[model samples]
Target: MAKQTPMMQQYLEIKAQYEDAFLFFRLGDFYELFFEDAKKAAHELEITLTSRGGTHDRIPMCGVPYHSVDQYIQQLIEKGYKIAICEQVEDPKEAKGVVKREVVKLITPGTVMEANLLNDKENNYLATVADFEDGSFGFGRTDLSTGESAVTLIEGDLNDVIYELASISAKEVVVSEAFASKYEDTLEQQLNLTVSVEEERELPESMEGLCSELEQSKLIETMAPLFHYLIKTQKRSLDHLQKVTYYSRNEYLKIDYHSKRNLELTETIREKKKQGSLYSILDKTETSMGARLLKKWLEQPLVDRKKITERHSVVQSLLDNFFIREELKDKLKEVYDLERLAGKVAYGNVNARELVMLRRSLHQAPSIRIM
Candidate 1:
């Protein structure tokens, strides 16, 4: 048996906290991976796998340069792998034996905010499911990039939960340990969703305001796990997160999962591509926000005749005025994704370029309103 190095000991301590994710341990100018993380990342990233001399034997090691780490991270994210970015908190010169390191960020498929990694036209949702003792389930979802949160109480079984998740194209799902043990395989293998477990069901006091509109305890319980998971993984101010919107299946036209797929409403059933879908054909939206809204409308058609007629009347008015419609489209094209930009601002990650975009987008608001 050999004693572990001080650096290795620190790495192990931090890695234990994020055992399910690839830990990118910062060393010098590189973000290194060791042992199993090293081997998997090396194979998945096609990076050179090397070895470091340990007290007993050679230890597997691989790393990517810090400057070019985003590309590697993007690749792993596309494959649905979570990454814990552990950075050296203190300078090496100031350290006693080993420099202090901590995980600054945990990038999951659902929680990604990088512009290059996200699809501008589509939302990436992180969902949470709560199994009630009465056979009903509470399903909550949030798009971290846009800070949009919503939840619904499904008076059905796990298949209904799956249908809701599939319809929304959730990238990852959070559940309790018991729920994970029972249905993790179906979620991961069948739907290809990344499953995360959270045991906390109590909603935090800071986030109580977000659920003020909800009266049902079940809905609040569902959102609590999701809110806690966000607090844990994001470790940032979620002020931009909107008030949780509660919806019912009766609010929308009832469409089963198989029926939605067969209808080719959003994507083709055969190729599962959006190019040949009804959404692709009907979509003439100028901004990313509009595109996302259009997709949501297609998935959840209005059941209320009054609401449907109101929407149709608005469309008809636009159709009647070509010049105004064209001007509105032009103004919309000049705008950026305000939803996500606001999220970044709330998360305190907004950069100078994004600020410039935000300014430009805001500048067009008056003209858009006049039209």
Candidate 2:
């Protein structure tokens, strides 16, 4: 084998850390991929595969422009591939030797926050499962786009956990190394989920506030692995991450996985599409946030009579006053997805246009309240 160049050495070192993802190593204006990554990305992304001259042999290489890389990333993410965005951290003019490049972000299907990639009507949830010795499991889910987080204890077998995951339509699942080794195939084959492993289970003090309301240690244990994975991959302040909500399965109406599919509550049974689902039929929500909430309500129908009655009374009030209902609808139309906007703000990715939208959404609040 030929001796590797200084830049190639750096790329190899960084690539070793993220073996599973395609490393988009930064090279000036283009984000290049080398070796197997280059070949795979070239084929998957439909980009031209080229070669870089090495000392003895040619090395496979491919790249997409940095400015237009998001489109390519979106394509790979849709195909359930992870991408490690290696960016030049230091200026070439200021660097001592090769520019300091690092993996700035790891984009997975569940962790996608880009506006163009996300669907306004739905959430992208990253879930985590922790199996206990007694046969029960802890399940936690978070929507990075919406800052919504929740954890629940499943007092059933792996099938029960799989059912809950299916209901949420999770794109990816994080689990312990042991858990992954045991159930990774099942999760992947059954739900077609991207399974990630996070060995950390201890809850850090800084994130304690996020789960302060939860008294159960099992809930904390379940949420910790997810938190660790988010912190590791995101590498930023998760300020928008809401306090983790804890819920028991008994609180909501129980529906088996088969029944959920048969009823087509969220997606059709045969086609597995959302067009003819119950959610789609009943959805008259004007805003994206309302649409998401409506789906959640449908998926987990309230079993408690008090809660059910409260929701029914609210609906009755809206029906009683036609003008008020129409006015509220108009106001809601002016509102943006506040949950996701807040998430972008915390992620430091919110642009000026989104900020203006946020302002406009806030302006509708007073009108909504009056109506």
Candidate 3:
């Protein structure tokens, strides 16, 4: 073995922190990957697999231009890989040694909020489950794209936990390092989820007020870790996230993964297309918000007859008033996807075009209100 270069040594130090992710070290206009990451990325991305340094001292390396990195990231994400974006923290012209670098962001499938990388029709959720001291278990789930968060406390067997997870269809699952092994096989083989094991911490005393408000003191054990993880990874205030909506399985009609597929409620059983699904038949929705809300209602039908009747009555009125119904639909067609737009704004990723779209979307509110 030969001595490593100063730049390589610095890269190694940062790489150790995110061993599971591909580190994209920013170098001028490109983000470079070295050693094993370079090899893997080159093979997967089918980019030029080259080397750095002189002959015997050479190391495998690959990179994409900074402007085009998103396309490369999308490819890696589709292939189920997490990316740690390492950036130049200092100016190269001023630095005496190798310019300082640090991981600015970590991109995972569930956490990606870019419109191009996400499906507008579906939610991408990251979930967490932890067993409490009592027989009960606490579950936490969130969709970063929609700024939605929910928590539930369930007391049952491991199968019961699995059942709840199946219904939500979370893309990623987080658990304490010690508890990871217990459900690793079940999560991988059965649910096809990517599991991430993180260190656990005692429930924070600061969250006491929030827990009291939600009447979910028990969720402190399981749910707090998810909030902690998001804060750490995002490194920003998630102002769009609503209060944790505390719910239970009994709150909605229970539907398992197999039953959802069998019934073709949201998607067709054969090709998984929406054209022949129940959703397609009933979907006269003009806005993305309406479409998503309709899907949620279908998936979690209310068991309460009064609530069901109320919804039916509303629909009946809309159906009976032909001109008003058409007016409402016309106005709704002018509305954009406000939920996702709000999410982007909360995440501090909204641009001028999106802001214009949001403004236009809101302008339709008056006409909708008139209906």
TM-score of each: 0.97, 0.96, 0.92
Give the Cα RMSD of candidate 1. Answer: 1.4
Cα lDDT listed for each candidate: 0.93, 0.91, 0.83
What TM-score number comes out for model 3?
Answer: 0.92
How far off is residue 278 in model 3, in Å?
A: 1.9
- Model 1 CA lDDT for position 180: 97
Off by over 4 Å in 1: 54-56
State in Å the error of residue 140, model 1. Answer: 0.7
Better lDDT candidate (1, 3): 1
Best by TM-score: 1
Model 3: residue 212 alpha-carbon error in angstroms: 5.2
Clashes (backbone N, CA, C under 3 Å), per candidate, total 0, 0, 0
On lDDT, the leading prediction is: 1
| Candidate 3 residue-wise lDDT, 264-316, digit = tens | 99889999788999999998788777887888899888988888999999999
RMSD of each: 1.4, 1.5, 2.2
Q: Residues 1-371, candidate 2, lDDT per residue (tens digit)?
A: 57888899999999999999999998999999999999999999899999998455889999988899989999899888899999999999999989999999999988998889999998889999988888889999999999989999998888889988988989999998888898899999999889999999899777999999999999999999899999999988799999999888888998988888899998998888999999999999999999999999999999999999999999999999998999899888889999999999999999999999999999999878776
**Which 10-residue window of candidate 2 scores lowest in summed lDDT?**
50-59
